[model samples]
Target chain A: MEHEKTQIERHTSKQFDVELEDVREQVLTMGGLVEQQIANGVKALIDGDSALGEDVARSDYKINTMEVAIDEACTKILARRQPQAGDLRLVLAIAKTITDLERIGDEAEKIGRMAVHLAGKDRPPSAFRQISQLGGHVRQMVRDSLDAFARMDTEAALAVAQHDAEVDREYEGVMRQCITFMMEDPRTIKHMLDVMWSVKALERIGDHATNISEYVVYLVGGRDVRHLSIEELEKEAARAISPRTGQ
Target chain B: MEHEKTQIERHTSKQFDVELEDVREQVLTMGGLVEQQIANGVKALIDGDSALGEDVARSDYKINTMEVAIDEACTKILARRQPQAGDLRLVLAIAKTITDLERIGDEAEKIGRMAVHLAGKDRPPSAFRQISQLGGHVRQMVRDSLDAFARMDTEAALAVAQHDAEVDREYEGVMRQCITFMMEDPRTIKHMLDVMWSVKALERIGDHATNISEYVVYLVGGRDVRHLSIEELEKEAARAISPRTGQ
Candidate 1:
C-alpha cells in the first residue's frame, strides 16, 4: 500500500509538471503574437497604413482573451498543484508576466490608434524616421525579452534591462525634436503631438519589455531584482546561478 | 488521536486566516500611502513645490520596499496554506492589487520628477488649475477604489471604473489645450510638454485605479469582467453578488 501511494504521488507530480509546461507555452504563444502586433503596429504608423493600424487594434481582443485564459490556467494550477518553492515562483512569475504582456498589447493598440489618426495627416519626413528608430529599438527589446523568458536566460534578461536606458535616451531625443518642430511652425503642433504620443507608447513598450526581463530574472534566480541597479542585478544573477558562490 | 488532529487542524486554519488578514492590511496600508503620494506629487507639480516633489520621489523607495514585503507575505501564504476557492481568490486579488499599487506609485514619482523639472518654468496660468482638477479626479478614484477593495463593494468598484472615462476625457482636453498653448507661441513649448507629461501620468494613474476596481469586482463576483462593457459588467456584478438570480 505504501508503494502504491508513492506511485500515485509521482503520477500527480508528473501531471502537475505537464500543466506547468502548458502554462509556459501559452505565455510564449501570447508573447509571440504580441511581438507581431507591436512590430506591425509601429510599421503601420511609419508607413501610414491606417488599415494595418485598424487591424492591430482589432486583433487586441484576441490577446485579451488569451490573457484571461492564461490567468485562469495559473490560478487553477496554483490551487490544484499547491506548488512550492521554485514551482510556486515560476507560476507567480508567469502570472505576472502575462499581465505585463497584455499591457504591452494595449500600448501597441494605442500606437495603432494613433497611427490611424495620423495616417492622412501631412507631417515632416523626419518624424517618421525618428519613430522608425525608436519603434525598432523597442520592438527588438520586446523580441529579445521574450527570448530571454523562453530560455530562462538571466544574462539575456539583464541585458534587456540595460538596453532600456538606450531606448529612454532615444525617446527623449524624439521628444525634443518634436518640440523643436512644433515651435518652428505652429501648424505642426497637432501632428507633432501624434508623433510624440507614438514615441511615448514605444517608450512604454520598452518599459514593459524591461519588466518582462525582470520577471525572467526572478523566475530563474528566485530573487526579486526590481528597482535594483544593473550592477546589482548582475551580481544577484551570478549568485542565483551559482549558490555556492560567496558573492 | 483523531480528535486531537481535528483540534490541530482547526488551529492551523485559524492561524492561516490571521496571516491572510495581515496580508490584506499590509496591502491596504500600501494603497493608502500610494494615494497620498499621488496627491502630493500632483499638488507639488501644480504648486511648483520642488521640495515636495523631491520628497514624493524619495518616499517611493519606502513604497517599493513595502510592495516587496507584501509580495513575500502573499507568496508565503500561498505556499503554506494552499488556500482554495474564495480564500485563494482573495490572495490572488491582493497580490495583483499590490502590483498595481506599486505601479501607481511609480507613476506618481514620474509626475514628481516632472514637477521638479518644471519647478521654475513659466507656463500659462491655466495649466496649473487644469492639472489640479485632473489630479483631484484621479486621486478620488484611487481612494474610492481602495474603499471598494476593503468592503468588496462591486457597486463602488464599478463606479470607479465609470469615473475613469471622465478622467480620460479631461486628459484629452488638457492635451488639446496644451497643444494650443504651444502652437500660439513657440516660447511655451517646453513647459507645455512638461504639463502634458504630468497629465499623461495622471491618466495612467486612473487606468491603474480602474484595474484595481476590476480586480475587486473579480474577487467578489468570481467572474472576469475585464474587456466587458460597463453595462455587461454591471450585469455580471449583479449575477455574481446573487448567483441564484438569473441574469
Candidate 2:
C-alpha cells in the first residue's frame, strides 16, 4: 500500500510540473506577440502607413485568443492540482499578469486605430520624434518586465516600476506640446488629438508594464508591491530579496 | 466505509457553500461602495465642488482595500476548496469581476481628481450640461449592471452590453464639443482637456460595467462572452438562458 501511494504521488507531481511549464511558455509567447504589436503600431504611426496599422489591429485577435487560452488553462490547473505555497502564488500571479498583458494589447490596438486615422494628415516632424522616443522607452520597459518575470529577477522588476515615473513625465511633456500646437493652429486640432491619445495610450502601456513587474515581485516573494511608492517598494524589495539586509 | 465517505462529503459541501456565500456577500458589498464612489465623483464634477472631489479621492483607499481583501478571499477559496464545474466557474468569474470593479473605482477617482483641477475654471455652460447628461446615463448603466449581477439576470446583463454603445456615442459627441471649444479659445485648452478626460473616464466606466455584466452571463451559464459582438452576445444569452428553446 505504501509503495502504491508513492507511485501515485510521483505521477501527479510530474503531470503538474508539465502543465505549469506549458502555461508559462504560452504566456511568454503571448507577451512577445503583444510587444510586436506595440512596435508595429508605433511604426505605422511614424511612417504614416495605415495598412500597417490595420495589420496591427487585425493581429490583436491572436493576443486576445491567447489570453483566453491561458486563463482557461490556469483555471483547469487550479481545479485539478490545487497547488499550494509558492507554486500556488506563481499560478495566481501568472493568471493576473495575463490580464495586464491583454490590456496592453488592447491599448496597442487603440494606438493602431489612431494611427489609421492620422494617416495622410499633416503633422509636424517633432510630433513623430516625440512619439518615437516615448514608444521606444515604453517598449523597452515591456521587454524588461517580461524578462524579469521569466528570470525571476526581483531587482529588474523594481527597476521597471521606477522607470514608469519617467515615462509619465515624458507623456506630460508630449501632451503639452500637442496642446500648444493645437492652440496655435485650429487646423491641427483633430490630428493633435490623435497624437495626444496615442501618447496617452503609450503612457498607459508603461503603467501596465509596471503592473507586470509588481506581479513578478509578488510571485517571487509573495508580497504585493502595487500602490506603493518607489521608496517604499525599494525598501520592501531589499527585505524581500534579503530578509536580513542591514541587520 | 460507504457511510464514512458520505459523512465526509456532507461536511465538505457545507463548508464550501458557506465559504462561497461569504465571498459573494463581500463582493456585492464592494460593488455597492464602488457604485457610490462613481455617483459622488460625477456629482462633484457636475457641481464643481472641489471639496466633494477631495472626499471621493480619499474614499478610494477604502475601495482599494476591499478589492485586495476580496481577491485574497477568492484566491484562498480557489486553493483550498478546489471547486469543480459550476462552483469553479463562479469563483473564477468573481475573481475576474473584482478586478473590473476595482478599475471602475479607479476611474471614479480619476474623475474626482479632474473635477478638483477644473474647479473655478472658466468653461461654457454647454460643457457642464453635456457632462451632466452623459454622467447620468453611464451612472445608470453602472447601477443596472450591478443589479443584473446580483440577480444573475442574463437579459439585464445583455441589455447593459447593448447600452455601452450609446455611452460611446455620447462620449464622442462630448469630445467633439470640447475640442471645438478649445479651438475657438486657446485660453480654455487646459480646462477643456480636464473635462475631456473626465468624460473619457466615464466612458471607460461604462465599458467596465459591460464587462461585469458579461461576467454575470458567464457565471450563470458557464459561457465566456468576452470578445463577442453585441449581436453575438444576445444570441448566446438567449441560448444560455433557455438551453432547450430550440429543442
Candidate 3:
C-alpha cells in the first residue's frame, strides 16, 4: 500500500510540473506577441503606414485576451496545486509578468494610435531618428527581459534591468529633440505633440520591461527587488544564485 | 477523536481568516498613503513648494516598503493556508491591487520631481488651473476606488471606471492648452513642458485608479472586466452579484 501511494504521489508531482511548464510557455508566447506589437507599432509610425498602425492598434485585444487566460491559469494552479516555495514564486511571478506585458501591449497600442494621427502630418527633417532609436532599444529590452524569464537567468534579468537607465536617457534625448523642433517652428506643434506621445509610450514600454525583469529576479532569487538600484539588485541576484557567497 | 479534529480545524480556519483580514487592512492603509502622496504631490506643484515636493518624493519609499510587506504576507498565506475560491480571489486581488497602488505612488513621485524642477522656473499666467483640476479629479477617483475595494461594491467600482473617460478628456484639454501656451511663446516651452509632465503623471494616476477599480470588480464579481467597455463591465458586475439577473 505504501509503494502504491508513492507511485501515485510521483505521478501527481510530475503532472504539476507539466502544468507549471505550460503556464510558463504561455507567458512566453504572450511576450512574443507583445514584442511584435511594439515593432509593428514603431514601424508604422516611422513609415507613415496608417493601415499598419490601425492593424496594430486593433490587434491589442489578442494580448489582452492572453493576459486574462494566463492569469486564470495561474489562479487555478495556486488553488489546486498550492504551489510551495519556489513553485509558488514562479506562479506569482508569471501572474505579475502578464500584467506588465498587458500594459506594454497597451502602450504599443497607444503608439499605433499616435502613428495613425501622425500619418498625414509633416515629417521632421530628422525623420524621427531619435524616436526610432529609442524604440529599437526598448524593443530589445522587452525581448531580453522575456528571454531572461524563459531561462530563469538572474544575470540576464539584471542586464535587462540595467539597460533601463540607458533607455531612459534615450527617451530624454527624444523628448528634448521634439521640444526643440516645436520651439523652432510653431507650425510643428501638433505634429511634434503626436511624436512626443509616441516616444513617451516607447519609454513606458521600457519601464514595463524592467518590471518584468524584476519579476524574473524575484522568481529565481527569492527576493523582492522592486525598488532596488541595479547595483543592489545585482548583489542580491548573485547571492540568490550562490549560497556560500551570500550573507 | 473526530470532535477534537473538528475543533483544531476550526481554530486553524479562524486563524486563516484573521491573516486574510490583516492583509486586506494593510492594503487599505497602503492605499491611504498613496492617496496622500498624490494630494501632496499635486499641492507641491501648484504651490511651488520645493520643500514639500522634496518631501513627497522622498516619502515614496514608505509606500514601496508597504507594498513589499503586504505582498510577502499574501504569499505566506497562500502557501500555508492554500485559500480556495473566494478567499483565493481576495488574496490575488490584493496582490494585483497593491501593484497598481505602488505604480500610483511612483507617478506621484514623478509629479513631485517635476514640481521641484518647475519651482525654480517661471509660473504660467494661467496659474496651472487645468492641472490642478485634473489633480483634484484623480485624487477623488483614487479615494473612491479604494472605498469600492473596501466595500466590494460593484456599483461603486463601475462608477469609478466610468469616471476614467472624463479624466482622460481633462488630460487631453490640459495637453492642448499647454501646447498652445508653448506655441504662442517659445520662451514658455520649458515651463510648459514641466507642467505637461505633471499633468501626464496625474493622468497616469487616473489610469491606476481605474486599474484598482477593475480589480475590485474582479474580486467581487469574479469576472475579468478588463478590456471591457463600461456598459459591458456593468452588466458583468451585476450578473456576478446577482445570478438570476445574469445572462
lDDT of 3 by residue, B1-247 (tens): 9999999999999999899889999999999999999999999999999999999999999999999999999999999999999899999999999999999999999999999998878777564887888999999999999999999888898899999999999999888888888888888887787898889999999999999999888988788899999889989788767863453
lDDT by residue (A3-84, candidate 3, tens digit) is: 9999998998999999999999999999999999999999999998999999999999999999999999999999889999
- State model 3's lDDT: 0.91
> Candidate 1, overall lDDT?
0.90
Comparison by DockQ, 1 against 2, better one: 1
Ranking 2 against 3 by TM-score, winner = 3
Tens digit per residue, CA lDDT, model 2, A40-103: 9999999989999999988898998998899889888988898987888888888888999999
> Which of the predicted structures, 1 or 3, would earn the higher lDDT when compared with the native?
3
Model 2 residue runs over 4 Å out of place are: A243-247, B244-247
Residue pairs with clashing backbones, model 3: none
- lDDT of all the models against the reference? 0.90, 0.88, 0.91
State the DockQ, from 0 to 1, for candidate 3: 0.78
Which candidate model has the greater DockQ, 2 or 3? 3
Error of 3 at A156 (Å): 0.5
Model 1, A1-247: lDDT tens per residue?
Answer: 9999999999999999899989999999999999999999999898889999999999999999999999999999998999999899999999899999999999999989998999998867786788898898898999899899889888889889999999999998888888888888878788878888889999999999999999889988877888898889889778667854454
Span of ten consecutive residues with least summed lDDT in model 2 chain B: B238-247
